[model samples]
Target: MLTKNRAASFWNGVRMRTLAASPDPDEPPRMVTVPADWDQDAGAAFAAMAPGTGRASLADASMLWVGPLADHPQASHGLATRLLDLLLRRAAAPLPAVWHGLRGSAPGFVLNLAAFAQPEGGLEIDDFVQACETLAEAMHLLQPSGQTPCSLLLSNLDACLAALGLDYDSDPARAVAACLCALATTAMHPHSVPSRPGASAGSVPPASPVPGLTRFALARWQEAALRGRRSGRSPTHELLPETGPIETGLTAPGHALASWTDALLGVEACGAAPLFSPLRPDGRLAASTLARLAARGMSPEAALAASLAGNPVVAIAGPAATETMHRAITPFLDRAPEAPTEVQAPMRAAAGGGRRELPARRSGFTQKATVGGHAIYLRTGEYEDGRLGELSIAPARGSPVQRGLLEAVSQAVSLGLQHGVPLESYVETFAYARLGPGGAVEGDEAVGSATSTLDYVFRTLAHAYLGRSLPDQPQNAVPAEEPDDALLPLDLPRETHRPSGPRRRHGLRLVG
Candidate 1:
């Protein structure tokens, strides 16, 4: 039986309606309600979700609710306090914070200082920096001892920059980022003496004992990112200032920004800590990104090779604050079997051709057909956007050798597709290939005739995926008709034969 005290400890005084333990199958389910200990405002915020959305739990240890400071500038302090209080009660000690959403655990806490995606011209530069300053002050009040760690994230910064007619990879935007980082760092260390200009790395003043923000970083593109665009979303181009761009893995300026900010925080750089991670879900490049690369006449393999060349290894900062974070992450070090010997450069020169991965669960179909009495089965898998990503080919009736050969071919094709080889290239190469099994195709209306099973397979793929309908070759479809104007073969007027006599006798007669 769960007691009220036990429930209080588990839920941190949050109200919960749950079923009581009952062994009796015949007994009715009894609902138990535990009253909340927190105030009504936080409780109501926790219980009632925004319309058109389901309720979410604050009890999750990994989650950090970063309320929009732009929406409620005055409430930043109160909101931060309430959230921190709730988290402290619920989350385990030395809270976990994830900086890189891709390859690392989340941060203990993340706070949004400004809503950068303002489409309307209402946002001002002063206002944006002011909001950050205000949030920093609020954070200091909540954690005056600097014991509790928090990170500041600027959401929709890219869209905000675009709205202001600023390029993401330019100097002006970086100036804005530097200004924000400086302000937050000052607020975080209000009592500590400022470090002198050009101070030696070892001569910088020791960090303050007061609790404040640990560092700052740019946030990834959100679902609401497209809203900030005056002309609306684009099919070809994606908004900039994201964690990483599709065209290039990580922008050079973005990486420099992360490194600069971490340096401002007086810490060493680690793997994608202050900004973006190059890794994708499947530990490979995304099929869609590869396809886009292929469309641009760029070779995906070449791009990958260039990006991975001479990458700087990563290391964790040795500060005492990072010790707990380090211990928390030790278990996940070996999670990825192919993780590099050293972490990819956290903040360094820009690299291209990042891994694009298929989702754990994918969508696709299987196809069956016959070419000249040969049974062939074709299966395909697609990415999230229904782009063909994987292919499998098999023969229903074939010897072990033949089956092995077909399997090898399918595997090769599938790798090519994933690596950004266009389907058109494959279709053009194999469409009219001639071999055995020349005749009609069955179980598919798209292809009527083929010279070989390979021909039928590629032709069908061309019609289905590329929308290119290829006509069967005349020689393969039927025997070619002879032309009346064809030239006749010529023969020698007289046939010449070697002498039947031995060479020695002929030589002697000639000499005599």
Candidate 2:
């Protein structure tokens, strides 16, 4: 039972319907009172429910009678106070705040702020408490600032921060606040929310967990978010969790697979975070693992991807471990286990008198883009005149199969381009190729998903050097415009003239 903390006199507009513990079909039901204590027996026996403890306890828990704040967002302070009060109560225990939407054993309100997603490795109650505390810290950091994105705490973790449409030095406090508002009354478990007619919102498995929201919280969050958008301040795009449960594996918060990276690859880029796996449900990693990796070196984005999926030699030894390790990158591995060797498959048909050599003093550049939820590492070789000549696209290291194919295409394309093949000629050769768990076009919306990331990066390089823009997309679907400064380019060797020669048979290898 939630008794108002009357000692503090302020506008705490949380009006929850008293719990009516009535199972009898005849007698009128009474309400659970504030300041009332529910011992174990009372908690068990007196209850009216549509189902078990999961659904029944929460069914009549929170029938909010929101006032004008329900329609106004700038009035978020009032709303936030109300919601926070609920969390404070739930965190007190005895009467938990979030009861897993009745989907789990104990029924809880849609507002699950008291509940939190599990982190990498596993979870404990302390983790949930810390997450709420962090949420509180973030909520307080939401003021518009000109100095720094003080609230963008996880900017260095590209996979997690980027998915939320934020980066390091980009304020994500507003977005997190929006997510909290949205998740206030929604179930984290998809199975808990009613899906079919006459069916409970969350009656079975397969429910898509709504991050940071239950049904009611989502409604309040949406209302507040809309008003914020109209006022020309915080927009929905800035507040919501862009990646849903499936995209980020948030449905299973406690589980994530680990892969190992050499840590030496791209030392400059990989040296920021030791463990770069995607964020588990509550945006947490194994603290011990993070400390281990950080002490060693930065894990490059590729290694980050590998850490999530491909097994480190030391970590993988059994099927259970393999499953645990593979869980993170299941979506990225699209190659058939026993597919024919790609490098040799094209050798004969592609070797029509291979080019005598690759360009001397060619410029090499490495840039990374994330597709799906994984990072796609792209390295390019360009001619003296800044014309793109060759490219390599790959997932994280340790996946020999993917790396081999990427190497082949890069070498083949390098040879062909050196032999005078126009870069644009291969545009359609491998454009729109798709494989792996994530082919989502991350940096540039124009380059959508590619037939192969090798193709995607090469195409992207062509546009960058040629001063061309990608084909326009619908206004609504257009992504956050990438700023020029975001691209890091390297000019290898001395400048010279662009190469030209007759296209060679090796160009066949450049073809899809």
Candidate 3:
């Protein structure tokens, strides 16, 4: 049932090149031309890749293949291991191996670099730098065909920052990023350095060079990222030159650049590759971005800058990242899908927050009752976690105007609850309102009486969700009857003479 294009995408993700195909047939093709050395296991590996994504694999048509990077021995921590397992399971393709093959490589591979941190904090700078080195070495040795440009994504970055005992978004994390980049890039691109008998003390040695392995090159989008941040504006392709290498901030040993400038540059003055992190698909932050930065008390701008300074460990926002990758693989993609544009990209809430939608099949209950003899129906909806998410009130008996008003009020309250408004706020505002439909016994046992329907609704919610009870109002008192003589004044009224036309009358007339 797989379409030829979909199948091709799967094969591409698994690194199996399709050399040729048979003439069109009515049914899906069983076989196709591939490398003689192609491992059947590799092809099988992608059969269930990202199955939940409704595609053969994430690499199939994704702009950037992003996932967490795992250590060789695997993480000793359960949480780290479980997360890695989940990501790899969803991705289906194995690291390094999925990146292999002479036919072609992925447009880019984003490795979640933060996965290397220990769950229990206290990760030292040297240990982290060594971990980066180990990863670079392992990747280089595994994938002899170095066509794939791997990016170490700093997703879940704050956790790693915590492990390092560094404050989030502080200068310390940036400093560590630069140091790690210098050491790791040296390992990934050793040929850039001249031959020497031995590495100097405290200097990170380069790994043996691999043929066709490209030195770290800045993606076009990364330069735009730097420009955008520096100018405090969004960068456009038009503003970028057609041809030029971005200054990688490399400096001479005796240069007059200030110490702050050197630290800010984040790279050593060597002919080493510049590290840059790719943005998420369509230039939006990934779920991991929120977790790594915002939730951890870091800012997006800080993460982007750290990424630019030779730490391939951060997933950042950039105008060019997606466009550049799209350009690289467009030829292989099916023509039906349109390339993502900045304007067309979906916007998401930032600051480590996002809308949590309710499930399609929701759970709820309706309560029928009367408040102050005004019949009402109350309904409630809950989230998967059993939290209240929606509420609706309907009057069983009322004027058309009253019904409409109640409907509108219910909708407004429901919207607020769905948008994360607390139940307590509604309770405080409406629980004891003395409005029409005032004073009543409700069918519901929880609330025996209420000043108004809203009072009943909120009081019910308070009891159900807030675990608090409201006391009923005091009973109304009866008034005493007054004597008829009480209406008379205490003193007798003076009589006034009427006009001559009126005969003597016993009735007294009041003067004007």
Candidate 4:
């Protein structure tokens, strides 16, 4: 297993490489080179399946790198298919490395974003819709034919797609394919199954058919039917249809197909069947499953509590059930609970400005002021006044980092006023006076000369605040009382002499 540090290093390397090789802003992203032996057949197949027109090229690969997959739907679909083929061929290997590389590499994030951005008519965006279809096909092929981890891998892929906000659940066929993959995976790991008595006995009644799906599925079938939908063979049905009678040979005698009906309904009710599972509908947890768990050892309160702990899928199904589950689990949770602590305010303030008020109030521009040899502007307002203001400062042309310090002080003042913090509070909180006058002493020459005084001030202050060494230490720490260097002029050297007049028309005479 890769350690945390190793994984972190690997990710960091991937990021750096990605940034370095990123396509130019005006160009699309190109597929980077993989090992010669790495899924050569799959890559060839992908290249062969490139869309009829608008194929991916090395010059403009970024177009596929970071946006929705649908933006270039055709290409996206082709790529996904190629990747799946490669993955399946290498399923026996430790895949996390390869998966990380593929995901962190170009085209993955870009294509996903593009696909999600254009959900409707995804085919028009890119060939990725076809790729998703291919993925479904691959998933179906893997479940019964391959090893157990295949389903887990499929789950990871589903999670990745969902995280990118793609409509994995939007396509009924694709959803069913994914659910079947998950079921097969779950079957492999019997320990993972939640206990539900009578479910295995097949005594349960078939749940009511979910509404709207029959119409939706029929409409999809019809649309495909109109497309001439590839003649010569009927497409493999990934999951049993919810509306019609199942042809899976699940019937029993005397009850008039009651057992079969119960089996079908049980799958429907538990939302466990590939096509009909409710979890497949929105990618959320099932309420019935939670209820079953509650009937077992789990309590409603405990279930809800578990759901709240980042299991949003569970939370989405039954809030009351989850709550009850949480309550039931509370006693166990209390045995080892987190310690409480005081809430400290956030380090950074909210971005943008505070809420704007109506009938804005104004305060005197200057409450108190004094001038020196080099005068600088300062604004003052009352704390109690019903107005909010901002102060910003930056280096003034030639002024050094010291200018940044002054600006920071100004910002602190404004923040104090807005929060109704007192002057003393500001001084104490910041550990420094807002505005003060001090001179450099002879023994303080280590602070550097006046030319670099600003640098010295910034370095010293930053070190005290950040508890770290500052880059490029200044030679002087003394603040210049008179801002004489506020606008230092540039000096451009003048040429000592001019070039001799053009060659004097002697070329023709010399040739003669």
Alpha carbon lDDT at 378, candidate 1: 75
Q: Candidate 1 residues 1-512, lDDT tens each?
A: 22232243245444543323211224332323223443222232222221112333344421333343223444544544444442333211111222112223222222222233233442343444444444444433333343333334322233333334333344444434333333433333322212322223222111221112112211111112223344344412232221211110111122322222221111111121211111222234433234334434557666666545732111111111122222222221111111211222221113244324445445554567788777777766677887777665666434335655675677567656755778888888888887556688888888888888888888988887878899877642445445322332343232245466532222212121
lDDT per residue as tens, model 2, 382-423: 556777665555564324355456656665675567556777
Q: What TM-score, over all chains together, does every model reach? A: 0.27, 0.25, 0.26, 0.19
Candidate number of the best TM-score: 1
Task: Give Cα-based local distance difference scores for all models.
Answer: 0.39, 0.34, 0.40, 0.27
For candidate 4, the TM-score is: 0.19
RMSD of 4: 25.8
lDDT of 3 at 439: 69
Compute the lDDT of residue 502 as modeled in candidate 1: 38
The residue-by-residue lDDT of candidate 3 on 144-183, one tens digit each, is 3544443222123333443444433344454343333343
In TM-score terms, candidate 3 sits at 0.26
Candidate 4 structure quality by residue, lDDT tens digits, 359-416 = 2223322111111111222333222343333332222111223444664565455554
How well does candidate 1 match the true structure in TM-score terms?
0.27
Better of 2 and 4 by TM-score: 2
Candidate 1 shows a clash count of 17
Q: Which one is best on lDDT?
A: 3
- The parts of candidate 3 lying over 4 Å away from their true place are 1-353, 475-512
